[model samples]
Structure formats: C-alpha cells, structure tokens
Target chain A: NAGVTQTPKFRVLKTGQSMTLLCAQDMNHEYMYWYRQDPGMGLRLIHYSVGEGTTAKGEVPDGYNVSRLKKQNFLLGLESAAPSQTSVYFCASRRWREDTDTQYFGPGTRLTVL
Target chain B: LAKTTQPISMDSYEGQEVNITCSHNNIATNDYITWYQQFPSQGPRFIIQGYKTKVTNEVASLFIPADRKSSTLSLPRVSLSDTAVYYCLVGDPRITGGGNKLTFGTGTQLKVEL
Candidate 1:
C-alpha cells in the first residue's frame, strides 16, 4: 500500500496566491491531519479531519483550510499564501482508537511563498 | 498536550545501539509517548510507542520510566539507513481540544557513520 501520498512535492507561490495540497492515504484511516515544519521548529498541526466530511481546527490553523470530502483523501488549501506559510507540509492518518494515536505520514510537500 | 524535549543531535557507528531520550515533565495522565523518524525531505514515520515500562516491536524498543516524565527509544544494530531525525511526542488519546493531535518536537538527529 502507498500508505500516504502528497501531491506537488515542491511548490513556489507569491504572497497572496492561492493553492491546494492534496493528501491521499490507502490505509483507510479514520483520522487525517496536516502539519507544517520549519527549520529549527517542530511540526505543528494546521488542520485535521476525524472522518470523511468532518474537519477540525488544529493548533496552527491560521491562513489554512481543509476538507475531507472522501474517506481516502484530504485536501489542504491556502487561501492567501503568506511568507510565514513557506515550509514543509506533511500529511498523516491513523486508525481511531481511544488509546492509540499511531499516525502514518506522507512524503511531504515543500512550499515557498515569497 | 504536553511539550516534549529531546536532544538536538547524536552520532553513532554502524552496528552499534543508539538510544534517544525525550523528556516531558508536565505530561498528562492520559498522555502516551510516541516516537517518529524522519528522513530528509520526507514525512515522519512512526517508530514506537509506550504508555509505561517497556514496549518492544520488531523495529525498535520504547522504554518509559515509572514516573512517565521521560521516555527513550532504543535502536538495535544501527545502520546507515537508520540515520535520521527522531521526534518524541506526548499526546492525549481522547479527541479533546486537539490534545490527541500530534505536537512534534525539534527531533534529535541521529547520524550513523561507517
């Protein structure tokens, strides 16, 4: 299985431009998440989904939006890209369990907003 | 969501055992410790996890102290492929207020040299 796959391995955007990053998981997981990583900074959650058609705000949800229209897919969109949003974005999914939060992550998409 | 602290970097020789420790002094009662490995330009992957004492899997071993204030990830017979950043995370399993969402630390970079 392709565990998790993210589209646009690399992207460059001008400030205020809009873009979307797609994440797909083959594990049929119930939870999907979006996170961003910057140099010397830990990955922070931007948004997440509990299941298809359900989305929630994470720790760092500013300037980002997400949708889980399909069970196997989650989408992250940047309505107005900012320089602060230039970072590596990762997608992850996991089985729903009250005591288990083991997540499987995607390859990651590197985005640069100038 | 408790904060996690880990080493910045570590070096080891191939075939040697490598241990990366993480500290979470303010961990919650319902929190679990999880470790993830990330190669350059790739997303992080789950390595191991434990709630107490010891937990072993084919890939690695997770050791948690009785206090649960800190945890360690031990890699047996390290190889060049095992060289990567290791992140320790502590999170609540219940989907309450984004605590279940992962909060990554600036991982410890483990380098296995010949």
Candidate 2:
C-alpha cells in the first residue's frame, strides 16, 4: 500500500504566488498532518485534522491553510508564498488507536519561494 | 507542549553501537516518547516509541526512564545507511479526541562512517 504520497516532488515559486500541496494516504488513517522542515531543522507541524472535515492549527500555522475534505486526502495551501516559506513540506497520517501513535510520512515536497 | 533537546550531531564508526539521548524536562503525564529518522531529501520515518522502560524493534530500541524526563534511542551495529537525523517527539497518544500535537526540535544528526 502506498502509505502516503505527495504531489509535485519539487517546485519553485516567486513571492506572492499561491499553490497547494496535495497529500493522499491509502492507509485509512483517522489523523492527518502537514509539516514543514527547514534546513538543518526538524519537522514542525503547520496544520492537522483529526478526521474528515475537521482541521486545526499547529505550531507553525501562519501563512498556511489546510483542508481535509476526505479521509484519505489532506491539502496544504500557501495563499501568498514568501521567501520564508521556502522549505520542504511533508504530510503524515496515523491511525486513531490508543495503543499506537506511529505516524507515517510522505516523501515530502521541496518548495522554493524567491 | 513538551519541548525536547538532543545533541546537534554525533559521529560513530560502522559496526559500533550508537546511542542518542533526548531530554524533555516538562513532559506531561499523558505524553509518550517517539523517535523518527530522516535521510537526505526524504521524509521522516518512525523508528521506535515507548512510555516507560525499554521497547525494542527491528530497527532500534527506545528506553524511557522511570521519571520519563529523558529517553534514549539505541542503534545496534550501525552502518553507513544508519546515518541520518534522529528526532525525539513527545505527545499524547489519542488523536481523535484532541490534545495530541507533536513538537519537534532540532534532531540529532548521526554520521556513521566506515
């Protein structure tokens, strides 16, 4: 099973351009998350959804928006990309189980905003 | 939120055992410790997780002390492929009911050389 897959492995955008990064998981997970990783840093959550139609802000939610219209899909949108948004974005999903909190991540999408 | 602190970098030789420690001073009662590994240009992957005592998996082992203030990730017989950034995260196990946001700090970069 393709645990998690992201669209557009790499992209470049000028400041103020907008784009959406698509994340899809086939594992039927109940929780999905969007995170960004800067150079030499760990991943920080931007937004997350506990289930379909439910989204919440995360540690670094500013300048980013997310939608989880379907259980298997989560999309992260940059309304007005800026140079500070240049980082590698990753999507993750995990099952809602009391015994496990393991999150599976996508390959990641590299974005560069000039 | 429980903040984690780990070494910025570590170096080890192939076939040697490597241990990376992370400290979370303000961990909550319901928090669980988890470790993730990331290679260059790839997404982070779950390595091991535990609440107390020791938990062993095929890839690594997680050791959480009785106090749960710190945890250690042990890698046995490391190889060049084991070279990656290791992240320590603390969070609640339940995701559907809320209050399960993971905060990641700068991870420990493990460099395994031959």
Candidate 3:
C-alpha cells in the first residue's frame, strides 16, 4: 500500500502568492496531520484532522488553513505565501487506536517562498 | 503536552554503537515516548517507541526508566547510512483534550563516518 502520499513534491512561490498542499492516505487512517520543518529546527505542527469533516489548529497554525473534506484527503492552504513560510512540509496519518500510536508519513513537499 | 529535550548533534563512526537521550520532565501518566529518524530531504521515519523499561526492535531499542522522565534510543553497529536526525517525541494520541497533537523539538543530528 502507498500508506501516505503528498502532491507536488516541490514548489516555489513568490511573496503574496498562494498555494495548496495535498495529502492523501490509503490506509484508512482516522487521523492526519501537517507539519513544517525549518532548517536546523524541529518540526512544528500546523494543522490536523481527526476524521472527515473535522479539523483543528495546531501549535503553528498561523498563515495556514486546512480542510478534511474527504476521509482519505487532508489539504493545507497558504492564503498568502511569505518567505517565512518556506520549509519542508510533511503529512502524516495514523490509525486511531489505543494499541497503535505509530504515524505514517509522506515523503514530504519542499516549498520555497521568496 | 510534554516538551522534549535532546542533543543538537552527535558524531559517530561506522561499526560503533550510538545512543541518544531525551528528557521530558512534564510527561504525563498517559504519555508515550516515540522516536523518529529523518534522512536529508526526506520525511521522518519511525524508529522505536516505549513508555517505561525497555523496548527492542530490529532497528533500535528504547530504554525508559521507571520514572519515565527520560528515554534513550540506542542504535547498534552504526553505518554511514544511519546518519540522520533523530527526534524524541512525548505525547498520547488517545487523549482528545490535546487533539492528538505531537510536539517535535529540535532533534539530534547523528553523523556517521566511515
């Protein structure tokens, strides 16, 4: 199985431009998350979804929006890209179970905003 | 949410064993400790996870003391391919109060040389 996959492996955006990053999972996981990793720093949570039609803010939710319109898809949007928004974005999914805490991650999408 | 502390970087040679430690002073009773490894330009992959005592897997081992205040990720017989960033995460996904959030601190960068 593909597990989790992200669209647009890489992207470059200018200031004020907008874009969306797509995350999809084939494992029928109930939870999905979006995180950004900056150089020399750890990943910070951006947004997450517990199930279809449910979304929540994370530690670093500013400058981003998320939607979980479908059970297998979670989308992250940048209304106005900024230089600070440039980072490697990762998407992850996990089956919501007490016994299974492992989260499956996507390869990642490298974004550069200038 | 519990915050994790880890080394910024570590250096090792091939065939030597490596251990990375992480501290989480405020870890809750339901919290679990998990580790992830990331290669350059790639997403973080699961390594090992534990709550207390020790847990061993094919790739690594996790050791948590009875207090659960800290954890150690041990990698045996390191190779150049093992060079990457290792992150220690502490949290519980089953708790709805936190929305299953995960906090990732600046992970330890392990560099292995031949």
Which is the leading candidate under DockQ?
A: 3
Rate residue A101 of model 2 by lDDT.
81
The interface RMSD value for candidate 3 stands at 1.4
Clashing pairs in 2: none
- Kindly list the per-residue Cα lDDT of model 1 for residues A14-93, writing each as its tens digit: 99999999999999888899999999777989999888899999889989999999999999999999999999999999
Question: Which predicted model would earn the best TM-score?
Answer: 3
DockQ of candidates 1 onward, in order?
A: 0.68, 0.70, 0.72
Instruction: State interface RMSD in Å for all models.
Output: 1.9, 1.6, 1.4
Model 3 chain B is weakest, by summed lDDT over 10 consecutive residues, at B93-102
Residue A12, model 2, lDDT: 100
Candidate 1 or 3, higher DockQ? 3
- Decide which is better by DockQ, 1 or 2: 2
Candidate 3 lDDT at B56 equals 96
lDDT of 2 by residue, B7-63 (tens): 999999999999999999999888889998999999888888888899998999888
- The global Cα lDDT (0 to 1) of model 2 is 0.91
Residue B92 displacement in candidate 3 (angstroms): 1.5
Q: Best candidate, lDDT-wise?
A: 3
lDDT of 3 by residue, B3-89 (tens): 899999999999999999999999999898999999998888988778789999999999999999999999999999999999999
Q: Which of candidates 2 and 3 reaches a greater TM-score?
A: 3
Candidate 3 Cα misplacement greater than 4 A, ranges: none
TM-score of chain A of 1: 0.95
